[model samples]
Target chain A: MLSEFDLIKQYFARPAAARAQADARIGLGIGDDCALLNPSPGMQMAISSDMLVSGRHFFPDADPTMLGHKCLAVNLSDLAAMGAKPLAFTLALSLPEAKAEWLQPFSAGLLALADQHNCTLIGGDTTKGPLNICITIFGEIPPGQALRRDAAQVGDDIWVSGTLGDARLALAGYWKEHPELLRMDEAQHRQAALRMHRPTPRIELGIALRGIAHAALDISDGLMGDLGHILERSGVGACLDVDALPAGPILGTQIQDIRRRYTLAGGDDYEICFTAPAAKRAEVLAAGAASNTAVTRIGSIEAGSAVRLVDAGGQPVELQLQSFDHFTSA
Target chain B: MLSEFDLIKQYFARPAAARAQADARIGLGIGDDCALLNPSPGMQMAISSDMLVSGRHFFPDADPTMLGHKCLAVNLSDLAAMGAKPLAFTLALSLPEAKAEWLQPFSAGLLALADQHNCTLIGGDTTKGPLNICITIFGEIPPGQALRRDAAQVGDDIWVSGTLGDARLALAGYWKEHPELLRMDEAQHRQAALRMHRPTPRIELGIALRGIAHAALDISDGLMGDLGHILERSGVGACLDVDALPAGPILGTQIQDIRRRYTLAGGDDYEICFTAPAAKRAEVLAAGAASNTAVTRIGSIEAGSAVRLVDAGGQPVELQLQSFDHFTSA
Candidate 1:
């Protein structure tokens, strides 16, 4: 029964004491027409936005807390890919109705991740409609130091942080699209579902790899599709080792064909993929270790404009592995 | 049907020449994990976000071009209220489907206004879902010069730019809700609809009033409700002269009671309401004149925490005028 203003004030607006602590770089927080941010003098602001719709992006009855976490986490992943430190974010939410039962856990999940990264929620808008959450995040990075897709070198080694394909494997189980292909125990299913729901933005790994990596991006729409961005932008190609891709524990137990498909073409992985000079392999490993994340070399950049997929024997492995396209895919 | 990436590249992505001209402060734009913004050395970045849903914010079959324009215009109004110069914006759109027919004019309308304000569309996300458009805008202003809502002082004269109530009048006509109280000819109805659909953000007026105005905010919800934000933030009250309000040309011809109701409580008015010292009246008028916007004094900030409404003769008027609340309003 709360009005929009009352709902915003009750749920989203931070108290003065908390606001002051959370808003070191924020000149103004909520309750203003526009929030003001004072970026550090020599730093460039890195910005990205992501929108999640209820039925399209997640189940209509998905856990509100995880939904909130995933929304901000995706945007934070972009900042992580750019090697930018999180600063602040603005959320615009459209909901069918305002209910405390949903909002309380949602905000709690969102703010928890925000607090973990020292990111402030400066301002946002809330309205009544079909449930949609859009977040635009801001981060700071030293000028000329951001990891860019165009900077990939042809001889660089392609690396991925953490594991991939578990989220997609979890999604396969949930949707039952390939029931015969994907089989998982209850414990494995729960673990994979957690990956799909609660993605950790590799902020520390990105920051640590700042000058070590040449180009980087977060993998949301599978490894092949997302790494293609780096290849396309850098005017280069890559020779990916299908057998070398680091798969999640659960996915690693799957058949080789299923494992390759899920790891190479999975969506919602939220893991960073980067290219580093072969000379810096040790440095890259050190950076990953420093950030407490596992890094695996999956491929090597090539000269021609064709992504060549190869198995351990170096024979070309051909497969129709199209990445997830929101409109074209089911 | 275009894939998500192709849709973005075809419609929303700017050509290199256009991008070069638009992105002066942008280091990295579209095709990156995150866009990089190089803020001016001494300026603070002002940020605001707005979301519009299909049925809640507009008619389901509304003109796509105008809808695009209005979506960006509302966010621009926030920058105008803060006396910040527009720099860039990120759009996150959720659409039921990607049709070139809808996207063509929509991007044109959006980019046209952005070009007018020299605001670049640096980065965004597009997905399939119920129609929703969320834009987060960035602007820049010199440190300590932003027009904040909490800066209003007692005895300051409150002034408004442009006119009010035509948008709400158009809504009434379209909805036929109170047909007895509202009447309009075809031309008048078109004019009112234009007011509702194509609001011009007072960016110039706000920039000109940077040092002249004490507190400022754009009137979106209604004068009574939005101005209440300034009063509540500043810990002051106001004495409003209802007769002195500048109603839209069409609303000006309405009955006294109708004009009072609509002018005082109409939503979707993007004009700015600001407070300034009585001694700066000449400077305020010069600022308005320089911006080519009409400015009228409508009230005076008072010491007490109550907003009093009165007529030209200083006789108090009693009216139950509540501002539009999205969740609670019809």
Candidate 2:
């Protein structure tokens, strides 16, 4: 029975100081025309927005809690890519109807991750429409210190934080040619589904790699496709070792072709793929250790173009793997 | 042939120094995980997000250019209400399909208004989905100088900028009794329709009234409803003179009832309504002149509870007026 404004006030409007932990960046939060953020001196504000529409981004009846987590997590992954400390986020949520049962768990899942990352919900719009969640996050990074794709240099070792392919494996039902894979053991399926639904943003690893990694990006699309972006922006190529990729444990007895394709080209990884000088291998590993995230050396940037995948024998492997293009693919 | 990325690059990504002048706030733009904003010292970043769904917010075949303009204008009006200077914005666009014909004019109209306000489109996500445009705008305001709704005192005079009701009149087809009103001459209809489409945010007036206006807000909903917000926040009441409101010229021959409802309670005005002390009337008028806007005194703040509307005879006029509630209204 709550109006839109009432729904917002009761659910989304958190007290500025409640979970912010003395961070007075938010001058005014909800109930105003705009939320006010007081930036720290000498700090640049990093911002990114992502939209997730039902049927396209998620199933219409996906778990509300995980849906909430994934929406904020993807945006946090963007901030992590920039090595920006999470500050606050605004949610412009469009819902088919205001149902408390759905909103309760959704907000719980969202605010849980927000609190873990020291981020606050500042302000946003909640309207009636086909379900769509668009979140814009603001973070802080030192001026001139942001890791950018254009800064990747030749000879830089490419590293990925955390493992890849788990989410895609969880979605093997949509992978075609893998109908039996959905019959995996309950525990393994749960693990893979968790990875698909609740991706960690790798915030600490990103912060630790600020000066060590020259260029970085979060893999949302497939590894081949996302890494291709780095190559295109940096005007360089990569020689990736298919066998060296840290893949998910769910691919226990899968064939090399399936493993290679999933590991080298699967999407929804939410892992940070970064380029760094080979000399900083020890430091990169140390950063990985400090952040408690596994850092795997998967490839090296080359002067030429084309992201060439190689087998364990160092021979070229040919595979047609394209990133998820929402428009063209759908 | 264009993917979401291509559509963004060809249209929304403006050159680094296009119209940002000497401001170095945007350190990075499109193609990055996040855009970086370096706020000026001693300034607060003001942010607001607005979403316009295709069917709910606009006609499916509405002019893409005007839709773009309105999308950004509403957010700019939020900044204007906060007495903030425009900084940058992020656009999260969900499209049913990527057509250059639609995107070209859409981006052009969006960017033109952004350029006019010195706001740069920094970074956002574009995806294929149901048509929805969500824009989150950032602006800068000095500490403690932002016009707040809770700052109005009991004796402050209420003022509104420019005229109202033209927009609601343009859509008078929804007004039930207004089939004949739409038969006005082409120029009149054009003027009214223009008001309905392209709302000019009173940014300058907001900045100029920083120290003068005790409280302020942009009227997106009807006046009576929006003024109730200020009264509620300021813990006061209002006595609005219905006849003193600045109504559009197109409503010259309209009946008193229609004029009262449209002028006093119509939505989509986008005009600034502010409260100032009676002694600061000259200063308020001066601020209005400096901003090149007409300021009309339509009401006063009082130490009581209801928003009472009085007619020309100084008699109380009883009418129920409510603002547009996204959920309840639709």
Candidate 3:
């Protein structure tokens, strides 16, 4: 029965873990009309925003803690894509009503991940409405060093961080026609849901790959669609080895074709996909090792305008893998 | 019909006026996953967020153009309250569907205000959901010079920018016993609605008062409620001359007591309230004149713990004015 402001103060106003750093740049945080951040003299602020809505973005009864993690994680993913180091974030949340049970764990999950990345919650707004969470994250990067989609080189090798399709596997309950496979054991269920709900933003790997990767973007709306953005921006295409694409163990039990399509087209992986010189292969692996994230070279950027998949014999695969479009996808 | 991404490209991806400034700091704008801002050295970044839901924050059938203006206006008001110069803003918009008829004018209104303030449209997300608009604005102020709520000192003169009560008076249709006043003529109706809808954030005035005002905040919820925030933060009280409170011409027709109540308790007034030393009264007036915003001295900060209103005869007025609480108010 708390008011909106009261709810914010109780749940969301906890001091950020990053606030204790000696070089912390937060000048003023929550309780003021605006939060103040003091960016270092030579650093550029990287900013991004994401909105998640109930029913559209998640099930109405989805786990509140996981939802909270996903909300901030998606925004942090953008900063990761930019090769920017996390700083602070603001949340503008709208809910049908305020409830203590839902808010306490939600803030816990959110702040826990925020603490992991040293990102601080600076300022935001809370209101009464249909449930929606919008987060804007800020990060810092040196000038001219951010990984950009337009910087992809035609000859660069394309790589993806982490295994793909586990999140979609978790969402099999929604799209899978065979209901029996949808019934997962507790371990598998938790693992798959963790992929979908508590995505790691690859902040460390992004920072490590700063100068090594030529161009980069996070995989949110599937590898195929998101890579298409790099292709269009850099005026190049790519060729992927169908047999070489990495998939989580959960997808191994699925049919080969289904596994291929899901790994390529299913969204919400929150993994970084980048292109780097073939010579930097060792460095890319080193960067992955430093961040403790597995990096797989899946393809190579090419001269044409279409992304094509091929077998080991270089025969073209005729599968049409459609990406998850927010409006057009089921 | 447009997809979410398509809608963003078509409407919200326009370039910013600040991009033309010699000190243009935007490194990457709309098309990127994250926008980059290069903050000048020794400047602190001021950040604030606001969310406006269709029926909760405005009339369901409200003019889309005005709604757009108000959404960004409220956030700008926060930056103004901190005496920060706006740099950029990201709009995380959720709409039931993408309809060009609605988006065209909304973007026009939003961008027009953004252009006037030299604030750039950076990067944000567009999604399908119930209509919600959340904006996070970034502004810059000199380090340690922001107007903070907790900085009010005892015996400082309190001044307000612009007139009050018009916005709440426009809401008379909701609270008034007689409905005839709601049937105002076209010009009158538009004029009154303008006060409620297109509130002018006193950005210039705030910047002008930077060194003069000890503390400042915008009047969003009633004057009594917002002043109470300053008092609570600063550990002081205030004394206001009830007869000296400013009201719009619309409030002139109301009963004296009703006018006093609405001016004191009614919210949505975006005017600023700040405290300054009595010796700086001339400078405060000059700052107001420089910004072309009217200034009125209505009260003074005191050493106690209550905000008391007094009449011309110096007799205290015993009255309780509740501010608009979103959860508790209708």
Candidate 4:
């Protein structure tokens, strides 16, 4: 078992690369009873929380380190939706029991992401349960400048950052407990599984999009499903272009068979999906470039109040929207 | 099972009583998907998170509403310890199954306390897991005004707010699953049961203690145990007046049988254990009185290496230092 001191040092006390991009006034990161960060001037703090349960969010045997990473990633995604710059986070970890070796690697993974994102571990709680991890993240955005799901405007272009479906394909092909194709080199499988375990939250893209994007949300529950949130709240609709979507190579190869199902249904890709006005397209692209972030235009807003799929020829296509719904039939 | 909408509306949407003395930045309370708050000028936000799980923090059959209240209350205690004014909080609730009846009352209880304390609900995650509720709260304090556990000085006067041991007594007498008691109306038993279920956090008093209390922490664990944390971190010991110690009526009744075990081992009862100087006693009392909060002098910080509980005759009592340790066997 890992000692409490060592567990913190290994997992949580570390930093991520983008941390250098964090705003000044962050006094300490991880290893303290609480983390301290000085709020940026003229900014209001935004906070969001998430919980991942073993056997629900992941398989029981998923690596603990990756579990740690994914936990922080989900909360970061929430901050992204608010167009808030990541600052710090607190974790509430409940395990069936404390095991030192498990904690060491888990903390390492969690700290690694925190270091990469420049997010400090501010405070946490530990207890006994069926291995549940809840993370609450803190970020800041200029007041009234926050990107919201209700702000999508008519005549806006819909966009998503990064390729989708890789996580879903990995889950179906690589991480399955019983694989039909005993495939993808074990190391490659580990990497694919790592993606499933630790998704990169688009904090930079989110912050950059604040003044550019009209409405934004992090794509945790597949593009179609999460984008539905914007349409619902904004009282608008979208015409998603199937051909314009940034697809994982695996999805492309399986497109003839899987029919882009994973891209439409897979939920773990922690990317940001947003809408920008036609007039601000250049500014949006410029902000993306300035932040060294990659973003792709995928769709357009519609005056009609229904989401539809458009084929490459701009014809509506029939497709299954198998998005993640906690209450939907399993 | 509780529907998501009703659960949110009934439990989480309620607001606290008007605090004209409180800050005016809580622009919106708990009705919307995300709460909006105005940031106070020159203040930095402090955050903390804690999770309570059934079979870990309480019995599985514990009143779900009280369980919900306790989870949010504890996180509020963290903010109190920092001398921050309550602003907003996010709740991540995981349940094995969805039950609308359970959710409505549970959210009602949470909203009741939130309304009284003026903390808004911004955003949170709700999913399926073994019954656990994780609350992450945010508050703001003036720059460098947040009190912490590590700031105790040797000359400070040790003080505790409210009485203790009622929680221990409630757990022992009211929490036990007695079929005969369950069959009876048992109003007194039920109220006692509430203390064991929902422990109120001291937010108002904590804010008042901002510049007055030198160092402070919420006594979630028993006085001896939590104070030991201050002593260990501050590198000093204490001399507690056993007779002056406030145990309320329950502990007084139980100390005769269990020999003061109730006072020494009770958990929950989110009260503040703090240290100030002799010169500030009247100020501290006035602060509590102004807030309808009670505080008592229980001990004094001393130049010593260990804690010594002195009796009314000024003789040292050889009592074993016992308190709750979550990791250790009960």
Q: Which number leads on lDDT?
A: 1
- Clashing pairs for predicted structure model 2, backbone only: none
iRMS per model, in Å, is: 0.7, 0.9, 1.0, 2.8
Instruction: Estimate, for each residue in A75-194, the C-alpha lDDT of model 3 and write its tens digit.
Output: 999998999999999999988878888998889889888888888898898888999999999999999999999999988999999989888887884555566544456587568768
Tell me which of candidates 2 and 3 scores higher on DockQ. Answer: 2
Which candidate order results from sorting by DockQ in descending order? 1, 2, 3, 4
Q: Candidate 4's residue-wise lDDT over A71-143, tens digit each?
A: 8888888777777877778788887766777887788778778778777776677766688898877777778
Q: What is the TM-score of each candidate against the true structure?
A: 0.98, 0.97, 0.96, 0.89
Off by over 4 Å in 1: A15-17, A21-23, B15-17, B21-23
lDDT (CA) per prediction: 0.92, 0.87, 0.86, 0.72
Candidates 1 and 4 compared by lDDT, better number? 1
TM-score result, candidate 3:
0.96
Predicted complex 1: DockQ: 0.91
Q: Can you list each candidate's DockQ?
A: 0.91, 0.82, 0.80, 0.45
Per-residue lDDT for B57-166 in model 3, tens only?
A: 88877788988899899999999999999988999888877888889989989988988998888878888888999999999999889999999999999999988887
In terms of docking quality, how is candidate 3 classified? medium
lDDT of 4 by residue, B163-202 (tens): 7767766666655534332222355445555666777777
Provide the TM-score, chain A, model 4: 0.86
Question: TM-scores for chain B, in order?
Answer: 0.98, 0.95, 0.95, 0.86
